[model samples]
Target: MIQTFAFYLFAVFTIASGAITIMARNPVHSVLWLILAFFNAAGLMVLVGAEFIAMLLVIVYVGAVAVLFLFVVMMLDIDFAELRAGFIKNFPLGMALALVLLAELVLGIGAYRAGALELGVPDGTAMAPVGESNIEAIGALMYGRYLFLFEAAGIILLVAMVGAIVLTHRPRTDVRGQNIAKQIARRPDEATVNVKPEIGKGVSL
Candidate 1:
């Protein structure tokens, strides 16, 4: 009974937050709404016996993605009023797309309920050992079966990071930059001069 109530609570909050994420006029408020939706979605996952995925959703989406999104939105200098001025002009097209998506969602849900697709296909992988946690099971599958794919994903992300750095890194020619090679090559004799000055007199360089 408690599980059912919690499920409904999470579901309602998730849907409401999602709607507000789209409808909020302020982008920062939209991001906050998005974070709320993510949190409730994680609660739903926890209720469904997917605690591992729930924790991942909170850690990754809420901790990293949502915070990054909020920072980016706050930092950007955009004329949102000007951007929103065309909302009326685009409303018809946006409504048409929304209707199309709604129709597709309804059709998919109906098909799923009607058992239009066969779901249980057995792949030759060992089931989780008795008394082993779901997290351990998932780890086994990821490290044992999908290790190469996981490594490839890491490589792809690394490449993307390098690409972003290369694209955004601009060298400034307006100011002088430190020359490490020149500094390293300098000898004490070249950098300094032994000077003898008359007593109580200033020395000229």
Candidate 2:
């Protein structure tokens, strides 16, 4: 009964949070909603006996989102005064939400430790040995059966990262760059032109 309730709770929250993430206009708010959605999805994964995948989802995706959130916040031309004011205003609500998520995580871990959740048994052909853990089984499968595919994926990601760096660092000859030495050596007279223009007429370039 408890398991059923928890599953529904996680599922509902995951869907709702995902929707909000898509709809949110503020990038920071969208990232927060995405983090919430990942938390709920992780809970759901735990209930389904895929705790390893859940951990990866949180660690990889949430961690990435946190970095993204930081960059987005830093790059934006935000009003710091308004931001501080909003933070003060929303601090209590944020705390409450954090507490609720923490409580849910605690309860989920407790339930799993107690072996109360059914966590349905695998019915596949590649069941693990009696003493082996699910993680061990997964590792074996990944290393033994899917090693080539995994390596390919790594190579693909490496190529993509290199491509991104190359694109961003490409040289441009048309644009004029700054000359620090020239600026330092320049006389004040060279920096300004005392032009006297006639009334109702523009000065020569």
Candidate 3:
């Protein structure tokens, strides 16, 4: 009843936002629509009893990724016309991919309705108690069963962040840089000259 209504509401918003995310002419608006889609998708996950995943979608995708995307899009001096110049050339490929995805989605839904997938099956005694919070249950599962996978995902994200930084980093040739190796290898004799002067005589430059 209420859950079904909520599910439909989230589904409709998710679909609409996703469409707008692709079709929006403005890149900033596209990102905002993407965030909206992520939020509604998270809501759908919550309705499906996957609250941990829902929170993660909000925290990671909405909080970090979407905001980062918005900031980057705003900061970059991109020419919208140049960016859209290839749309006509790529339209056929995009349409083909969209059709393929639509067919796959329809097949997936049909299979799900026909019970072709053995989803939501409990795995014996490892299930969490009904009264336990989703976060607690997810933490238990992540630490107990999927600790290595979780750590691997963290490592992957760290590597990706490092890669992004490296890709965007540019060294300036105008600025003088310290040569530490040369400094370390230099001898006192090479860096300085000892001088002796007679009484009342000043050193010449």
Candidate 4:
């Protein structure tokens, strides 16, 4: 009873927050609503005994994804009023796309319920003991079966990072950038200037 109640509570909060995320006029407020939705979704995952997924949702999605959205909204010089002015103009097109998506989702669910989808569970007969950690199992599968895909994803992310850096990189002609090679190759005598002063009384200018 407690579990069911908690599930419903989280589900309700998740749906409400999701609605707020889409309907909010302010971008920052929308991001906040999305973060709230992520939190409630994480709670729902926890209710289902998927602690790993719950933690991932909170740590990765909420912490990283939602925070990234918040940062983007904060940093960008967007005219919200001007953007909202076109909302009515785009409402019909947006509503049509939304309805199409809703129809697709409903059809997918109907197909799934009609046994058109074949979902498979892993064979646990030859698995470890019940007391064994799930992390070990996940690690084994990740490193064994999905190693190539994992490495590919890492490389893709690496390329994306380099591309982002290259895209945002601008050379400023006003300020001189450091020359590491020249600095490393420089001698003390080349860098230091010695001034010689005559040790005399200040009698004449």
Steric clashes per prediction: 0, 0, 0, 0
lDDT of 4 by residue, 1-205 (tens): 9999989999999999999988999999999999999999999988776777888899999999999999999999999888888998899999999999999999999999999987888787546456755666666767887899999999999999999999999989999889999999999999976666568643342
In model 4, the worst 10-residue window by lDDT is: 196-205
The estimated TM-scores of all candidates read 0.79, 0.57, 0.70, 0.77
> Candidate 1 — which residues are off by over 4 angstroms?
109-116, 120-126, 181-205
Instruction: State model 4's lDDT.
Output: 0.88
Candidate 4: residue 175 lDDT (0-100): 95
Please give, for residues 73-105, the per-residue lDDT of candidate 1 as tens digits.
Answer: 999996888769788779999999999999999
Q: Considering only N, C-alpha and C atoms within 3 Å, which residue pairs clash in candidate 4?
A: none
Clashes of 1: 0
Best by TM-score: 1
Which digits, one per residue and each the tens of the lDDT, describe model 2 over residues 1-205?
Answer: 9999999999999999999986675768878888999999999999998988898889988888666786888698988678678878998999999999999999999999998876877777687868987889999988988899999999999999999998899678999998999999999999999988999899888
Model 4 quality (TM-score): 0.77
RMSD (CA, Å), candidate 3 to true, equals 7.4
Please, what are the lDDT tens digits per residue for candidate 3 over residues 28-64?
A: 9999999999999999998888988998999999999
Each prediction's whole-model lDDT (CA): 0.93, 0.88, 0.93, 0.88
Error of 3 at 35 (Å): 1.4
Is candidate 2 or 4 superior in TM-score? 4
